[model samples]
Target: MDKKDRSILALLQTDAKLSISDIAERVNLSTTACWKRIQCLNEGGYLRQQVWLLNSKMLGLGVTVFMSIKTSHHDLQWLRKFALGVRDLPEVLEFYRMSGDTDYLLKIVAPDIAGFDRVYKKLIQIAELFDVSSSFAMEEIKYTTALPLDYTHTA
Candidate 1:
């Protein structure tokens, strides 16, 4: 990727609805060239699926919980089953296997504590867990879906 490609990505990250013509104009590239570059980026896996971010608060899902999970089962069979169970839960927006004290981390959003309790109940039913801890987010100081392009290889 070159400077222009990086610029294109930056603009798209800001607003995915921007037209090819608008992107072309901003990046100082012709429409056709801009389209080609975008296609290349998509083909090369630099561009993942495009999605519209929804307002959780407006949608009645204002509560955000960061759940830390620790389990004794480290085998693949247990992991596969646990992963599949977590994937089935729509309330879990993000899940990760981590190092250090925490075995797994889950970012969950719900309507309230009662709603979160429902998810927690289902989660514990998935498998035998050593520990499960949760922390509620009081305020979102900074949150963004956009990633920095400074680390991208320049041509």
Candidate 2:
């Protein structure tokens, strides 16, 4: 990607609603060229699907819990089952297979402690886990969907 593509991506990352003409003006490109570049970015997988970020608090999910999970079973079948089971749970916003003491990590959002307890009950029912520990976040310092564009390869 060149400087123009980087600029375009930066703009889109902030707000995906910008018109082609608006982006073209900022990037110093013709409208058609700007449109083509966006298409290329999408097709080349540089631009992932755009989404509306919803506030958990406003949506009645105020509690944020980070769950560190350790399991005795590490076989393919067990992993697949665990993956499928967790993916079905709506409260789980993010899941990760980690590289340290914890085998897996899950980010769960709940309305309150009671709601979180329900989620925990559901999780233990799904599989046999060696350890399941959760830490509640008191406050969110900073969160963002935008990625830094400085790391992108440039011409």
Candidate 3:
């Protein structure tokens, strides 16, 4: 992507509510050009779906646990079953594949200890996973949706 595209992305990253005209004016481009650029970005898969970030505490999901999981197998058959099981669990806010001793890392938000217990029991039934390391989020110091703009690449 070019600098102009990056600029547009940067603006949208901060506040997606900006109108096409507003964006065009700021970037010194015509409205049609700005709209076309946005459309191209969407078509090219640079623009993902927008989200409304919610407060877990206000939603009565005050407990946040980061669970590190180590699976017995990463084979396609076992992975498929694990994927399906996680989809049914409402408490799993985020699931990620990482590089470490853990195969999967989950960011789970539950209402209480009882909620966590129920989810944990269900996880065991779904896969042959034996290792789990869970940590609680005591306080959030830095949380951001914006990516850093300072990556210098050599091509």
Candidate 4:
């Protein structure tokens, strides 16, 4: 990507609601040119999707937790089943297949302890897991909905 493309992406990452004209003004480009660049970025798959950052607390999702999962059998078939089970679970906001002691890590949000309990119970019934440890996030000190934009210079 060009330097202008990088700058355009940086601006949008902070606020997707910015008008094309406003973005063009800030990035030293004409409105149409800026709009074309954004469209290219999207069509080229550089920009996947835009999302609204929501506050879990304000939505009554008062509890957030990280679940570290491990399985007795690390076979691929079992993993597929596990993934499918978690795929549509509304409480799980994010899932990561990690490189560590755990096979997967899940970021979950629930209304309260009881709400979380319901999710917890349902998940255990998916498979006979070796370990499923939870670590509640007491406070999210810094949560950024944006990715760091130093990728322009990457080889």
Off by over 4 Å in 1: none
Per-residue lDDT of 1-155 in model 3, one digit per residue for the tens?
A: 66667777788877878999999888888999989988897899877877767787898998889999997797999988998999899899789888977889998888988888888888889889969888888887787788765562312
**lDDT ranking of the models:** 1, 2, 4, 3
RMSD of 2: 1.0
Q: Residue by residue across 54-134, what tens digits does model 1's lDDT show?
A: 999999999999999999999999999999999999999999999999999999999999999999999999988999999
Task: Give the poorly placed runs of model 3, Cα more than 4 Å off.
Answer: 150-155
For each candidate, what TM-score against the reference? Answer: 0.99, 0.96, 0.87, 0.94
Determine which window of 10 residues in candidate 3 has minimal summed lDDT: 146-155
Clashing pairs in 4: none
- lDDT of candidates 1 onward, in order: 0.97, 0.95, 0.84, 0.88
Best candidate per lDDT, number? Answer: 1
Evaluated at residue 149, the lDDT of candidate 3 is 50
Candidate 4: tens digits of C-alpha lDDT, residues 1-155: 78788889999999989999999999999999999999998998888788878878899999998999887777889888888898879999899888879988999999998999899898898777888999988988998877777866732
Counting clashing residue pairs in each candidate, in order, gives: 0, 0, 0, 0
Best by TM-score: 1
